[model samples]
Each structure stands twice: as C-alpha cells, then as structure tokens.
Target: MRVDKYLKNSRLIKRRTMAKKACEQGRVIINEKIAKPGDEVKPGDIIEIKLGTGSTKVEVLSIKDNVAKNQSEELYKHLKGF
Candidate 1:
C-alpha cells in the first residue's frame, strides 16, 4: 500500500493529505531511508514518523484498502512513540 494511505487507514495520521505533507517535508522514513508519500509499504517494514517535537515508530504488520477504526491498530505494531 502507499505510505500515505497506509498511515491514514492505520490511523497513525488523521488524514491522507497530512501524511503526504509529512512525507514531502521528510518527516516520514521507512527502513531508515526517507519516505515519499507514494512509497510502497509492506509487512515487516519499519516506519518512523517525525512530527513536530515527537517521533513515532512502527512495524508494518498488514495492509488493507479499508479498515475499521477499531481494527486499525492491527495494521501496524507500535515500536515507539509518544
């Protein structure tokens, strides 16, 4: 899945646009490399997001086009974050 979509579907970010902006600004990283909004993400990939003064890290667990709010957390495993 696309990183922006994954972020939104996983509920890591509130919106896809915000995720895209974050990526454009170099706030998103995957596997230790900077990530673009259209970057492909898969299971087992490590994702790090630096937003404002905080940082969040997660391991991709699964990918889906659509996910329920209650089940969003199942898409990724939180490695570290605020």
Candidate 2:
C-alpha cells in the first residue's frame, strides 16, 4: 500500500491529505530515511511520523486491503526503538 494511504487507512494520521502533506514536508521516514507518500509499505519496515512534541515510530506488522477504526491499529505495532 502507499505510505499515505496506509497511514490514513490505519488511522494514524486522520486523513490521506494530512499524510500526503506530512510526506511532502519530509516529516515521514522509512527505515531512517525520508519517505514519499507513494512509498510502498511492507512488513517489518519502520515508519516514523514527526509531530510537534515528538515523533511516533511503528513497525509494519501487517497490511489489510481495508480496515475499520477498531482494527486499524492492528496494521502496525508501536516501536520503542525509535
């Protein structure tokens, strides 16, 4: 899935446009490198989202064709390594 779509579908960013903007501004990273909104996502990849206070890091655990809000978090697991 595309990084922006994954973030939106997973409910991590609230909206696809927000995710896209984040990526455009270089606030999103994959494996410690800046990632574009179109970046493909896969299992075990690390994703970091920059925010005002701190950034959020998650490990791609699984990818769903589509997910519900209650199940969105199952898409990625939080990482303490960040």
Q: After superposition, how far is residue 53 of candidate 1 from its true place, in Å?
A: 0.6
How do the residues 1-82 of candidate 2 rate in per-residue lDDT, one tens digit apiece?
8999999988889999999999999999999989999999999999999967688999999998779889998999998534
How does model 2 fare in lDDT? 0.90
lDDT of 1 by residue, 8-35 (tens): 9999999999999999999999999999
Query: lDDT of all the models against the reference?
Result: 0.96, 0.90
The lDDT, on a scale of 0 to 1, for candidate 1 is: 0.96
Error of 2 at 2 (Å): 0.4
